[model samples]
Target: MKKLFFLPILFLLFACNGNAQKKSSDKAEEKFEVTKTEQEWKEELTEAEFQVLRKAATERPYSSELNDITEAGVFVCAACGNELYRSEHKFDSGTGWPSFDRAIEGGVAYGSDSKLGYQRNEVHCARCGGHLGHVFDDGPRETTGKRHCINGVAMDFIPDDTK
Candidate 1:
C-alpha cells in the first residue's frame, strides 16, 4: 500500500514539474526575441507608426484608413511589416478602432499592460514586439470573445490582388 501511494505521488510531482517547465518555455517563445533599439524602431516606422507602435498611442475611433477596407488581404505590422491579422478575421466592433476577432496564428500576443492602472492586455506584434493595442473581452460571440483593438497606424492593409 505504501509503495503504491508513493508511486502516485511521485508521478504527480513529475507531472506538475513538467507542466511548469512547459509553461515557462511557452512564455519565452510567446515573447518576441528582437533586440532592436527605440531609435531603430523609430527609423523603421513612420511618424504615426512610431507613435502607435512605440509610444502605445491610441488612434481615435472610426478614424482608421482600413476601417472601411473590405478587400481580402493580410494586415501587416506597419512598423516591422510582420503579418499580424488576416482580412477575413477583421470585423466591425463599433468601437472606432480596427477590430479583429482573431489573428494569424502566432502573429500577435497579449501581455499585462498597466499603463492605465486597469490591468488590460497589451497586444503586440509577435515578430517584433511592437505595440499594437489592447484586447478586450467584449467581442462578437460568433467567434472568440477577444477583440484585438488595433491602432490603425500599427497596421497596413494589403488588398488581395487575385481578384
Candidate 2:
C-alpha cells in the first residue's frame, strides 16, 4: 500500500538527517586557535588557495609548484602561517603532491574524512582549520609509515636560515 512506500522513504530521510547532525556536532567539537569569516579568508587567499584551503577542494595532481621543492624549510599554513611540517619529514610519494612522513608537533590535526565514501584521515591546520590534505598508510616503512599527503597550494615554505 501507499503507507508501506511512505515508511521506507521516511526511514531513509531520518537516517540521513541523523548522520548530518552527527557530522555537524563532530565539527563543532573541533575548536581552532584561529577563526575567520568567509570573506576574510577569501580576501587573504588566492583563488586556487581559497578553493583548496577553505573549500577543501583538492588541486590537480602535479599542478603544485612545491612538489619539486628540496630545500630545508618549514611548511606553513597558507591561511594563518602556522608551521605544519618540517622539510626533513617530506618525501616524494609519487602521487604528484607534497608528501610528508610526519607533521610538526601541535601544528596539524587529523580528522575522519568520509568525503570519498570510505573514511580516510584528513590533515588540516590546527591554527585555522584550513584544509591541507589527507593521510594514507602506504608510505615508507622506515619512517612513520604514514603518508601525510598535502596540497602545495595550502602551504607556504619558509626556509631555515632565511637570512
Candidate 3:
C-alpha cells in the first residue's frame, strides 16, 4: 500500500515538472523581427523599462501616467517603436494599467504564461518580442470583449496632431 501511494505522488511530481519545462523550451525557440543582445538592450533601456519589456515583470498598479491620458494617438512599443494600440481602442478598465480593447492589426503576438501557476494569455511585441502584459476575457461586451491589461512602461504614447 505504501509503495503504491509513493508511486502516484512521484508520477504527479514528474508530470507537473515536465509541463513547465516544455512551456519554457517552446518560448525559447521563438524569434522576433527585431532581436538584440541582452547587453545591448540593457544599454538602451532604463532599468524599469528593461524589467517590464525584457524580463516580463509587472509594474505597480496606477503608477503609470499613461493610465490617465485620453488623447487621440497611438501607443507603440518602447523597444522597437512598433505601432501597437490605438487611442480609439483604449479604455479605462480601472485596473490601473493602460487597458485596451484591441491592438493594432498584426502589431502584437500572444503566448502562454503559467508563471503564476495558472494559464494566462501573454501579450508580446511582435517586432521585438518584448513582454507587454496579459489579455483577459473580462472586457466590454460592446466591442471585442477582451481586456488587454498592458504595462505602460513597455510602451510610449504618441498624441495625434489634433490632440
Against the true structure, whose lDDT is highest?
Answer: 3
Q: What is the TM-score of each candidate against the true structure?
A: 0.76, 0.87, 0.87
Note the residue pairs that clash in candidate 3: none
| Steric clashes per prediction | 1, 0, 0
Candidate 1: list runs displaced more than 4 Å. Answer: 1-34
Root-mean-square deviation of every model: 8.3, 2.8, 3.5
Model 2 deviation from the true structure expressed as Cα RMSD, one decimal place: 2.8
Pairs of residues clashing in candidate 2: none
Candidate 1 weakest lDDT stretch, 10 residues: 19-28
lDDT, candidate 1, equals 0.80
Q: Across residues 91-122, which tens digit of lDDT does each residue of candidate 3 receive?
A: 99989999999999999998888889888999
TM-score of 1: 0.76
Model 3: residues >4 Å from true position, as ranges?
A: 1-17, 24-26
Candidate order by lDDT, highest to lowest? Answer: 3, 2, 1
Q: lDDT by residue for model 2 over 1-163, one digit each (tens)?
A: 9999999999998888665345621444788889989999899899999999988899999999889889999999999999999998999999999999999999998777677667778888988988899999998999999999999999999989892
Per-residue error at 6 for model 1, in Å?
A: 47
How many backbone collisions does model 2 have?
0
